[model samples]
Target: MQELAERAGISGRTLRHYHQIGLLEPDRVGSNGYRYYGADAVSRLQRILLLRETGMPLADIAGVLDATTTPAAETEALTGHLEHLAQERAALDRRIKAVEHTLSMRRQGREPRMDVMLEGFNDRYEEEVVERWGRDAFDASNQWWHGKSVQQQKEWKARADALLARWREILQDGHEMDSAKAQEHAAVHVEWFKEIPGTPTHAGDTAKSVDMIRGLADQYETNPDFHVAFGTQEAARFAASALRLRVRRLEPSSADDLRG
Candidate 1:
């Protein structure tokens, strides 16, 4: 076990923890109580580490490993992980270039352009938006966002943070999802949604906005990241329910037609 741990560049304790959690187990255990791992164990350990680098929870990692019953499946999963890592690397490179531009401009005694100042700070949700809504929608939204000044962008982000914080506090206070305050909060959420540049709400299309709100409600309930952001899966579900109810109440004429 010690040799295997050393070979894997992980401590013996971590190896033992993996064993205890049924993540990885030794191929054999001697009568004297020492554990032994084989070459397969080393390969599995490397895959586990790679998945962990993608921020997958241990339970999800186990599921992914279990689901890869064949070499083909394993290769497919690893390919997906490689794509994710590549995107992360690209984002970091953009951020580094943005910072370098800022520093160079300062050294030259000139103000940095808004584009240079805002690079890499925005678009964390670019991939998610593109996947959910279509490339055209994402492109329009991204273009609108990049056109804003740094201060405007910061103020917009601050408003978003404040809204999330308010929801967190409201959930922590044990308020019911359909309570009056919760509905009011949902109204504010929709109002905030209207301020975005590329959405249907911004275009004064009430029908499309209703559809978007319903889609958002479903996303809040189902998206794992939303659960993480909102403090819990249950909290996300609550927010979804509140938003759905508020949308139904505010746009009763279109409520029946709103698609999830």
Candidate 2:
């Protein structure tokens, strides 16, 4: 047990705790009263450590292992986890590059461009919007957006972050697509739309509020930038469905037009 624990870079007590939690059960109890792990156990232990290193919670790991059965299912789960990790890694890489660039500028006694330092952060949101709605949509919005003060822009971005964070939390809680909370989110989303200057006018109707909301949700579902922001395609779809339902309930005409 000690040897195996040392090999795994974990203490014997930790290994025993894993067994207690049914994560890594030993192969057999020897006549000498020692727990001995077989090859299968060792491999399982390695997988657990790999998942841990990738920042998965112990409980989530247990849930995933319990829920996965076939090799195909296991592979799918791993693929999803890997995708999430890859996104996180990309974000980290951007931050690293920004820091390096800033350091190089400082070494030359020059100021880094604040815009460059902050580029990828806001670009992701705009990229999602443009990709889903089209350059014309963003161009229209940008005309109104360029009028905003830097402080106002910062405020808008903070609100956007909060909105996305709430959506993520709702998904993490395993909320239903058409739940009351989702409708509330849709309502806040409508208000967010109103805050944007040219978006509502771009479609040319105040009564098309619901259509606008549903359209944005559809965009969120199909856009890769939006999928990353929301963390899962299912979550994006759920938000879209909920927003569509809300639109139907609130503005039947717009909903009908959009659905048509």
Candidate 3:
């Protein structure tokens, strides 16, 4: 058991916890009370670790594994997981290179470029994009982003940054969520969301667009990345509140339904 844990780079306690939760079981236990894991157990552990990286809960992962019976099924599952890891690795590589270039520029007494800083950040909400929209929506937007020249990407990012800055300024000016100015800005924000190639907004699916806006409003209030982007937690929360109001207006008939 200790050897298996060491091999997997996880502690024995974690493996034991998995055992206690019925998520994993040792192949056998010695009379002296040590646990042993066989090859099948090791393979299961690998899958568990990979699925967890995708933010899946342990219960869902157990169900997924339990349903995957054949060698071919295991291979298919691993292939999908590998693709997700590759996408994340590519994003990380771009961000790393961007930071490295910025460091080099700073050492040479040059200002780091904002456009260069925005590279690879296009995939920041891949999980949310996939969950709210679909894999096709994510792939379409990803393709749209990568197809842009560095200059074009920078221009798009500049518009997005300006919009967020506007939100921050509005909140700083003490605009209430239901205030006229705040509601106007929220409407503009919804229109801006349609600029993306593959979203419910761009597709003109008003109902889906309202749903997407609601989900994103929740994210803005909860996600720390939005806090940093909006320049403060207060601004993020305000943006979320304003967005919720805009969506409710968009779907007045569903306002009561959305309250829960």
Tell me each candidate's TM-score: 0.46, 0.42, 0.52
Candidate 2's C-alpha runs over 4 A off are: 1-140, 201-207, 253-260
- Give the per-residue lDDT of model 1 (tens digit) for 72-111: 7656766776787786776587678779988998999976
Query: Number of the top candidate by lDDT?
Result: 3
Candidate 1 residue runs with Cα over 4 Å from true position: 1-139, 253-260
| Higher-ranked by lDDT: 1 or 3 | 3
Candidate scoring better on TM-score of 1 and 3: 3
Q: What do the candidate models score in CA lDDT, each in turn?
A: 0.72, 0.68, 0.77
Give the alpha carbon lDDT tens digit for every residue of 1-260 in model 2.
Answer: 88999998999999989989988889997899799999988988887898788777787677666776656655766778888888677657656876898899899998664441122113335686565555666655654555567698688777776776787778778887678787788767665665554454235354545545666677777876576666677776777787778777766455333222
- Candidate 1 lDDT trough over 10 residues, lowest sum: 113-122
Positional deviation of residue 257's Cα in model 1 after best superposition, in angstroms: 16
Clashing pairs in 2: none
Candidate 3 structure quality by residue, lDDT tens digits, 34-123: 999999999889988987887656876777788757656546666776787787787787779868988998999986644312222246
TM-score of candidate 3 on Cα atoms, chains taken together: 0.52
Score candidate 1 by lDDT.
0.72
